[model samples]
Target: MFRAARPFIFRLDAERAHWLTVHALANAPWAAGWAADPVDDPVTLMGLRFRNRVGLAAGMDKDGIALEGWQRLGFGFAEIGTVTPRAQPGNPKPRIFRDVGSEAIINRLGFNNGGVDACVQRVARHRAKGMLVGINIGRNKDTSPEQAVDDYRYGFEAVYPVADYITINISSPNTPGLRDLQAEAALDGLLGALADTRARLADAKSVHRPVLLKIAPDLDDAGIRSAAAIALKHGIDGFIATNTTIARPPGLSAKVSGEAGGLSGPPLAEKARHVLRTLRAECGTSVPLIGVGGIDSPEAAKARIADGADLLQLYTGLVYHGPGLVSRLARAVSTS
Candidate 1:
């Protein structure tokens, strides 16, 4: 069904088509039943049980509007947002571009979420049924670098009770200076603040939740090790490697490839894989890792598992391979 609709959907503007799809699923979650049922290869990590290994990456559902829809679509887990403390309109128009020939997308959407309060409310209503749901949090674009930790703290507190896990998203290239948080000094401060906050919250709330860090694929060898070291130092729960890439690969000839933003899709597979491998080597299996990049096929998914990813996520893969890819990957990695 997705294959048949792909042509018509592709004809529309990339972002428009995205909303149409999101809203459709939002209104009629049963629509997800068209895809195969999710596999039952349970895994326990970070003290949370996941029905399967494949998850919907953060950017796909910026708002928590379609949690049930994603569950019905056969994802074992779904991550929503790069949500901010306060609502913001995000970057200018024409921020999302699609390159069909290259099977890639360049987006500078700048987090454009409905704030943590709104997202938390939506998440509270879902009741989670069978899917493990995570909320990805980020600071508002206008928040200065100095005050970033406060914004993240606000987000963490707002979403903590309702979220099964929380992802600290500092890797998006579209957000100005967001990546700087990955630096050793800045990261230590940010994660240290959150670690302290989490300790307090865990005591007050009577429950402990895992916090994962999402990093960009553009980081160099030294940078990757530094980020991993800091994450471990702060007792961070896990790592999602990675978000997206800014460097264009050799053969990407699509016109939009030149667009200034983070690129995701087939072209990103190698770079993302490298980061995942590097993180695993640095962290040495002590921390769990979630691999997200160009996993559009069963082979790519299996490769991620072989490379030490405890789980896998899909975004651009769904764009190119359709919803059924979720179940296929779950089955592929379930036994691997």
Candidate 2:
């Protein structure tokens, strides 16, 4: 179905098609529990039980609005948002682009979304029917570094009830001073508050949902190691192997390379795996890792598991390869 419709979808601006795709999928009968049955792998990681191994990455659904639609598409899990404390229009139009030849994308979408209150209501009303769900949280674009912890805390507290797991987004190169939070002191402060918030929210007769940190692919060895250590010290639940990369490694044409944004898709596979392996070794096997970045095929998904990613995510791959990507990845992970 997607293969046949690809040309039409491709003809519209990337952002418009993205919303149209969401609405179309949401209205499809297959989005409900009875229609789209879960894949059989039954992955259990970070205290959440997912029906399949493939997850829709953070950026795809920047607000909670698309969960029902993404759910209909057969994903084992769908992560929505990089949602901020307050609403804001993202970067100007033309912020998202496709690199057709490279099977990649360059996006500088600066965490656009309605505020936490509106997002929570939207997800509560129209969330995915039966798949695992994660909410990725971020600070407002103008939120100062000194007040970053408060922003993450507000997001954590707001989404805690609705989310299956909460992903703290400190990566995205488009947000100024956002990556600065990755520094040792800044990360420690942020995670410490979030962990405390998690504890306060988990007193029920049930398990506490995991709180994962999404890191950047651009970090050096020292930075990666420091981030892992802070995660351990603060008892962070898991790690989203990477966000997106500002550095375009090699092999793409000069025109696409000149686009200023985080470059993702095939070129991100190896670097993401490197971060996954390193964090795995540092955090030990106990802390689960959900790998993202360049996971378009079964081979790439399997490679991520080999490199220590217990769960997986997809974005650009879905754009280039189409909707069947999740079912195909679930089969590969199950057989492996």
Candidate 3:
């Protein structure tokens, strides 16, 4: 059904189709059951319990303003926002792309959002459904690397109450020097400072919400080691395994090859798995890792479990496959 509807949607802008899908799913009476049953992907991560392991990734809900619809999709959990402290229109239009043949997407969205305050109020309104809601936090484009910690602190404090767990997104290549925060010295300081804030928030609230770090897929061996080590040192609760890659890789060098954006979907699957395995091995068997990037099927989600991911998330794959993809993935995992 979604494939038949794709032509009309494909004609519209990517962002508009995204909102249209959100509204459609929200109104569909059967979407809740359609997206959420037959629990094969049951879950627990970072001391928090998720009803399932499948989740929507950060970019899907950039403002936390789209929860009512997402919760109905039957995701064991849903993460909203790579929200910044304040609102800013991201990069220019045509920043998002679709590679139909690969069932993938490439985007340079640049963290455009309605800001933390608005997102907090909106997310708080629909958080009643019991599904885990994660808020992905990021620094605004204008924030210098030196001031990044304060930006993260602002977002963490503001969005903390409404989220089940919070994800720190420092790996996006589009942001100026943002991924540089992943370095050994920078990661140490950033994670250490973030941990202090997380501890304070946990103490005051009398609740321990996990703080998970999302990393880039392009890191070299040393970078991964340093990142994993710093995460442990700072008491970071979990890891998102990866964000997007800056490297185009051998598979995706098409005519759209030079397009400046993060490439995701099929071509990214293998490397994403490798990174998940690396993080899992580094963090040891006990540390929780949520895998993301290029999850297109129940098989891929299952591959994640096999690769040592405690859970999984999707964005690009969902766009190409449409609404039914969630149920397909959920059912597949349930049977596995």
Best by lDDT: 1
The stretch of ten residues in a row with the least summed lDDT in candidate 3 is 29-38
Candidate 2 wrongly placed segments (more than 4 Å):
29-38, 126-128, 203-207
Of models 1 and 2, which has the larger lDDT?
Answer: 1
Q: Tens digits of per-residue lDDT for model 2 on 183-251?
A: 998898888888887777787525577788899998998899999889878877889989889998887
Candidate 1 per-residue lDDT over residues 1-336, each given as its tens digit: 888989998999999988988998899999789786779888999998898999999988999898888998889899999899999999998998988888888999999988889999998888647668899999999999999999999999999999999999989999899999999999999999999999999999999999999999999999999988898888898899999899988767658878899999989999999999998888887689999998998899999999999999999989878899999999998864
lDDT of 3 by residue, 90-181 (tens): 99887887777776678898999889989888778877766678899999999887899999999999987888888899888788899889
| Rank list by TM-score | 1, 3, 2
What TM-score would every model get versus the actual structure?
0.98, 0.93, 0.94
User: Each candidate: RMSD to true structure?
Assistant: 1.0, 2.3, 2.0
Q: What local distance difference test score does each model get?
A: 0.91, 0.83, 0.81
The 10 consecutive residues of candidate 2 with the worst lDDT sum are 29-38
Candidate 3 overall Cα lDDT vs. reference?
Answer: 0.81
How many Å off is the CA of 24 in candidate 2? 1.7
Superposed by TM-score, candidate 2 places the C-alpha of residue 28 at a distance from the truth, in angstroms, of 3.6
How high is the lDDT of residue 177 in model 3?
A: 93
Ranking by lDDT: 1, 2, 3
